[model samples]
Target: MESGTSSPQPPQSDLLDVFPQKGLEPGDIVVLVLYFLFVLAVGLWSTVKTKRDTVKGYFLAGGDMVWWPGLFSVLMLAWIFLPIYIAGQVDMYAGAIFIQQSLHLDLYLAIVGLLAITAVYTVAGGLAAVIYTDALQTLIMLIGALTLMGYSFAAVGGMEGLKEKYFLALASNRSENSSCGLPREDAFHIFRDPLTSDLPWPGVLFGMSIPSLWYWCTDQVIVQRTLAAKNLSHAKGGALMAAYLKVLPLFIMVFPGMVSRILFPDQVACADPEICRKICSNPSGCSDIAYPKLVLELLPTGLRGLMMAVMVAALMSSLTSIFNSASTIFTMDLWNHLRPRASEKELMIVGRVFVLLLVLVSILWIPVIQASQGGQLFIYIQSISSYLQPPVAVVFIMGCFWKRTNEKGAFWGLISGLLLGLVRLVLDFIYVEPRCDQPDERPVLVKSIHYLYFSMILSTVTLITVSTVSWFTEPPSKEMVSHLTWFTRHDPVVQKEQAPPAAPLSLALSQNGMPEASSSSRVQFEMVQENMSKTHSCDMTPKQSKVVKAILWLCGIQDKGKEELPARPEPVIVSLEENPLVKTLLDVNLIFCVSCAIFIWGYFA
Candidate 1:
């Protein structure tokens, strides 16, 4: 592990470790974290007095949210998906350069630039600012990723050419003793069997996707944005919108790896003995440098930076969100609970302290992260999250919808899942070991496809099994059941009898003016006259009268011989135009998004 002047240059070997780049210095990491803290402080400072009055104000920004800010939050949160995808690209691209020394510098620069922009906006406006910036950033990322794909496809001479080239590469690898090869199926072959294969189909389909769902759906960092929505409809709509965006990445991230293989067939060969020895001596030195190298060497300059920025933006988006959410959870969930009646000023101060502590912890952890080797960042994060998420999801879901799920069940289930997950992780570590000769050789824990699936299964089974067993042994309190049933049950339906005809305008006025009529009014309009005839408590209408009665009934009111419904009273409306703060936020976000889009596009271009 040579240091200082002895450090090798980029593209010298695909295995060159990126930690030695010195770009993201300890100070830089600290600065990044501090930037987040500052942003949070500013946000808190603006709302401290308001937030002190209610939990909702602190947690949800008072919820009278506008469309632009809400949209921004959704977009910023959605940006998380980019980093999770790009981390894999970095791994793959670095791997591609291992064969040929055609790695590029623009790609890394692009990533760095994107991170800078994200940090700036996040620092400028807190969550609100970050969200608006993210919406535009997300669009750029999608465009940049897709553009790369299109160019790569055309470079390889289309899908048919890609397949032909792949097969030819595979055939050549077989003859010359190479590790690269084409699969038996076409491009769309998604389901690979885990039992007899290197990559498992079932593992990805069931195991990986489930953890993803849990992460994207239940994880606090992601879900916090949805919670911030003004209403449930907005929250649901925002989430679904992000879900649709999720389906676009397969083509963007994975296809580039395949394209790299086709274009640089020779690099796909086994690592040269010399490079392999260097890598073995310091595995962390070059393990994740592959994808960045490919991007720098291959893409045109302007487009290169755009793609790199997209990747960097992705990373920053996740880091900032995690930092903010972690601070939030620590302050609201832990600190506030301990000091239940803490003052607004005190809580804000406590939140800042927690932010500083978390940042420091993360900084300390970064070195440990750099020291470790193997596994893609995305996979590593997801696998670890899988172990932690299931039980939390179970408890939260049950607590929200099922009142019968007592605090005891919630506590025990969470504990059971955590313990089970930890035990499974330990067991898996002990059982699985690589058979390579080198001292540093270890099984690829993060890259293992089923890791998330395995952790999630263990966590889920333990939680449900423990919770269910506890449920029957100590039945839920009767009060709990009553509360649960109250929320869950449907209201009873009742029938009503028809009355004789009245004046048209009178009937219309009655229907319109009595808009706040009791539940019985709805029932009265629905019951048919013929059905009422059986009781003989009300008079039956003639055949033509029945037709008129049916028409009135459908409108949820008696016709009363009305030709038209009367106009209802004018509804009261509130104006927010006089609110200077609201106007400022609107102006800021609009300018912010526009400026960000221009800068990102221009810088990338």
Candidate 2:
């Protein structure tokens, strides 16, 4: 059963005593400090070399785009619908709450410190720093998780012993607790009864896929990474790498959770509300305690510290990413729209300022998030996304594939779907899930209809509304759309149609089978690309230049002047995934990933 509240008490000191655990040792502190220092050093180093004033340089990691239309969809299908990002960190917000309760530390202080660390690196080096730090975090996360998994499996006498203990505990829990705060007997099962299961079969099958699609394929937050790759091959290769990484969560996070439940049933699976609250400070349940609890309880001092560092790395990595992206979107897309003539220095300053603003907003939001899902981090995030993302997914999928999807249709469809979802969100907040022992006196629709199911209904509404509205409106001209859509991306004719009608510079003489461009035409062509496609800096007045130099120096940039950079080719947003070798590799990888997923679901099922 779901439960939530508006106010959360600070984590209790006796948290470590909940399941007979020792406090963090000095080595743990040293490891954590070292990790923080390393990340800060790397971020600042990136800042020294970074040109933060430019859009592509700042946000895109100075890399180009590679569009994916398949595996990312599958990637979404795996934990979210696989383990997914800031959301990962926000999910960890609940984790932080648990850690606070267990370690008896001030969670608010931890939150502020993390925000400070994340913002500093993020504001300094921008996207590149986020990427590099993420790589290091990934390695640390993998090592820490695998190390703990090994210990957990050994402690429980391996898989066979794990299952025996878990089912025994599960059965005993039901006998005593009955329906109150007892996990479903089909807890390990991924696909179960749509109506009764927390993860309904129907919702798992189709409903959750909608949001995953939006997140993996469409959301700027994710696609930004793909766009940062140098070429399409590298992009797909990066995706394949992500595909491999996706396999880690179940083994590392989810299964370890089950192990913890078995090992500390009295605490992790505390049935009584008062007893449960006494254990980890969440009356609803202590399911969120599985990770940090295991790390603290199982691992010895040094490894425990390393694991702590991993958690912090994950938290910081996610936080920095979120801050970087929020700032990028605000500065590049929205700010530019508001001030088209804004100078580069002004824009960079605004973007860094925006990161600070986001930190303030996130800090303010921590209490609401922790309380909303009864300290269940993943659930809170999913419930929120189910309300907001399905409509966006519907618009994007339709817009990309269907030529008839027009701006007016998208605008109104989004407005309608959002209004509906917002109504649900407001209601969900007002009618929070009651404690397990409390009467199930919730509204039928709110109580019975799952968020995943609602996702579908909302998506369907958006699609139909958009389609019907488009039919009545004036269709966009083929020329206006050009090669932006899947329907037109491949044909060179449509690609040409997208290009403006100005005379392209002619190369007069043939040299080594390549035409040599005339000097005048080449110069003319460079200016055209800068003005039309690239984010080039404008010349500043003497006084403005002096201030810009001072600002740049303060931000650790080398110079006040613009650098002459070669024009890049226009980005290809949609491409046919028709390469034989690449397709073969992807196919093989997909099969492996899917097979692994099926094995996991079947094991749990």
Model 1 lDDT on a 0 to 1 scale: 0.47
Worst 10 residues of 1 by lDDT: 77-86
- lDDT tens per residue, model 1, 1-605: 55567422212223333222213334434534454455445443443223222334444445544443343233322211112222322333332222122222343443343334333433223344444444555766788778888887777777766656654433122323544233445344555556645335666555665555556655566766766666544554465456446556656776666665555433332234333334322322232433443455466655665555555446555655654555557677778899865544355545545544544454344433333323234444555555655666566556545656766676778778778777655644454433232343435543342565565576567558556855776667654454234353332322334342323333343433333334455335423332533444323334347667653332123323222233333332322123466446545655665575455435423
Q: TM-score for each prediction?
A: 0.59, 0.81
Q: How big is the positional error of residue 66 in model 1, measured in Å on the Cα after superposition?
A: 4.3
Candidate 1 ranges beyond 4 A from true positions: 1-59, 66-124, 167-188, 265-290, 370-375, 396-403, 427-453, 476-605
Residue 55, candidate 2: alpha-carbon lDDT: 63
* Candidate 2 lDDT by residue in tens digits, 140-165: 88899899999988877787776666
For every model shown, the clashing-pair count is 21, 5
Q: Which RMSD values do the candidates have, in order?
A: 20.5, 8.9
The candidate that achieves the highest lDDT relative to the unseen native structure: 2
